[model samples]
Target: MPASISMDENMGFQYGVSRPGLNPPIQFGNGFYGAGSGLIRGGLGAYGKKICGSSSQYVQSNISKYFSDPQYYFQVNSHYVGNKLKIILFPFLHRGHWTRMTEPVGGRLSYNPPITDIHAPDLYIPFMTFATYLVLAGISLGLSGKFSPEAINWQFVKGMVGWLLQVMLLKASLSSLGGGEAPLLDMIAYTGYTFTGLCVAVLGRITLSYAYYLIIIWTSMCSGIFLAKTIKITLYAEINSYDANMHHYLLLAFPRNSNPKPRDSQNRRETISLIQKCKQFHQVPPIHAKIIRYFQVQDPFVVFELLRLCSNLNSIDHATKIFQQIQTPNVYLYTALINGFVSTGFCLDAIRVYCRMDNESVSPDNYAVTSVLKACGFGLALEEGRGVHAQVLKLGLSSNRSVRMKLLNLYGKCGEFEHARRVFDEMPDRDVVASTVMITSFADYGLIEEAIGVFNRARSKDTVC
Candidate 1:
């Protein structure tokens, strides 16, 4: 038996090292210290991966909302990204910053700050950091006399592959946890953050090879902590909300009575609201019939809703039938009919309807002009639209914001830069939308300098250009 050894009550072997001048070293029973330490390390590594994976899962679960546009994800709102790359590399050292949540609507990108945002998952940082890391890494390799383009390319590919693996792991973990349905690109953004941390380690290696290991340790710890904390906070609701709302969509198709009965004001409002929600859904044939039954075939508003929805759905023929049923169509209904025709490639039909309105001497509202001009633009009949512009001027509506924008859009599309610029210049009050339209027009026409000039001279910094 080894000296300075004892058996414990639990049957764990206790050992003590005999030092020349000490009674004995402190006892470590059985595999107490060794096994515990090993287990702790294993648990930490597994837990780190698990938490990080959950973080990815939470993001991807809302993938359509978050990851519909890859460009939007990679695009950093200047307001949010300003002076944050340095801090992003060492996120633990600098807390309390968030990335922008952005969406592209009608060819314009809008940004909003997330209610519970963490900065690490910003695609801007990942994209920029990945590029910068590769550049810095190449420089390091070059300095060490081991530079090769092939090797640098390999590193880039390897990093991307690693990011992909992280996304897979995250997606798999979340799916297993009953939260699978996250966006693929959102997962890409989250997993892609490795570049930010790896960038720091690469810089350290460039400075001193020994520093690489130390910085890597720091970076790994920081990543684990950030992901774990953020995941717990962000996904707590997401997991539960997802489950609760799992049946929400199925419930949308509530049991429709064999015949929808006319109800009270509250019921009518709810029916209209529900119809509005269902407008985007592809199953509109039944919905249209349901709306007619609900209104008992006398509500112009019901017809208006169906018309507008049919336009969006490109059901131009159906909308025309609904339009015919309206005994007295208001400007809103008229505009909806025109918009439906134009949106669904029935620009000629839209124009004929406008001519009929003119014959009937129906006063064309701003929406009417906007819809007609848009129809002209879609039809590529710039000359006809110019005549419509003349009518708009005669009606003293050129000053209308929407009219000017629609007219400007028309001229820009027709390759009439001079006309487009003239309208934009003549606007009494140029807002962000006007500026955005002008810049977009200039860009499309290959007038890069003009676009840049407009961008620089904009009074409002909020323009999408």
Candidate 2:
């Protein structure tokens, strides 16, 4: 205590300034209070030692459900053979709408072949093809005068081992990313499909020796495409990436001692959950800061989610700002931004983004094509819309149902009924959406009688949009 200082109201606690002719106290009092508080905490801890044990067990018990969440379980059913082959051959045609049955059913389709399923795992095709491949290999070996029982057996084992290695690689990669609860059998089913492509490649090798290389290349590409599409639809979205930000530098120093397994997954889930909450709880600036703190903004999934939330919240300006923050945006991220702009009635902005994406040499997906087409219709950029239609044709996306629907509606809305009618007539499978779009186009172009005919022909008109 200073001799010149007093605890009276007139001589209050002087902090920074020199009181009239008064010397300041040497003690700050903070350290003394802190020491007293530490002693009190220590005393309490010592006293509670007998009653309280380490809380690690308590926390382990409390959070067991989070680690064992049912949502993380990757279920599989593979009791079908026929339609499963169709799925492996052409996944792009998968409409992705599974049918449901209420009463007890009796067929393989009932258990394994979901009516409109896109990515369900199946074993029948792959296993049968593997056996057929062995037979084909034996035949080839016999024809080439290299046939031996031991050699044939070795070839079969080698193929199976290779398949197992592929399964293990995919499983390990997916598991580290918070997926791979899918069963070993489910993975075997997936990896074994490669044999079907191999069987075809062998036939080509036997029939046309010089063209075998072309056949091999084509079959390899198809196999790659099949695997990519299946994994994208089924497992890719289920996985989440860990944060690799510099904030974990200390954790890096003491690796094993500081970091726990599931630490990254927990952090990822928490960060995404926080970002989701920001659409409701925080304004754009705080949310932006939170995002920068938590995630890689350029990650397509994170960008997509943020853009989606911003659009849902009607914050198109914030989405634009976020889109600008991306360094090298991919097609999906660009589509998200374009969708936000188009959905909020910023048609010109959507078109501008589409152009920017084009100049970046990024090819748009079906969603982007449909979205930009709608934007063109709304903006009444008829020539620009026609140019996009030509681009769609050149890109081979003219066959896409959504793209067709958008093109027809765009033409009709711009008073080009002939183009709309051509688009409608060219559809190979004229379903409910196509029919509805045709009707709308006809009405927009003052063809009421044609609209009525389309309305009468449309089946299941419930989901016209």
Scored by TM-score, the top model is 2
Highest lDDT model number: 1
The predictions' CA RMSDs to the true structure, in order, are: 30.1, 27.1
Give me the displacement of residue 330 in model 1, in angstroms. Answer: 2.1
The per-model lDDT (C-alpha) reads 0.61, 0.59
Tens digits of per-residue lDDT for model 2, 184-219: 554676788888778887777777778889878876
For model 1, the run of ten residues with the poorest summed lDDT: 1-10
lDDT of 1 by residue, 1-465 (tens): 001101121212111111132222221222123422332332334433543565465455445456564554544555556544444455567654232333322212223332223342457767887899889989998998989999899888988888888988877876775564654655676666667788889898988888899999888877766555444433322343323233123344654445555655674666567668863323454465455445533465666776676566544654665665555567777788888766654454565566556544578888898998887676555655776787888889988888999999988877788999899889877777888888888898899999888888885455444
The C-alpha TM-scores of every prediction are 0.39, 0.41
TM-score of the candidate numbered 2?
0.41
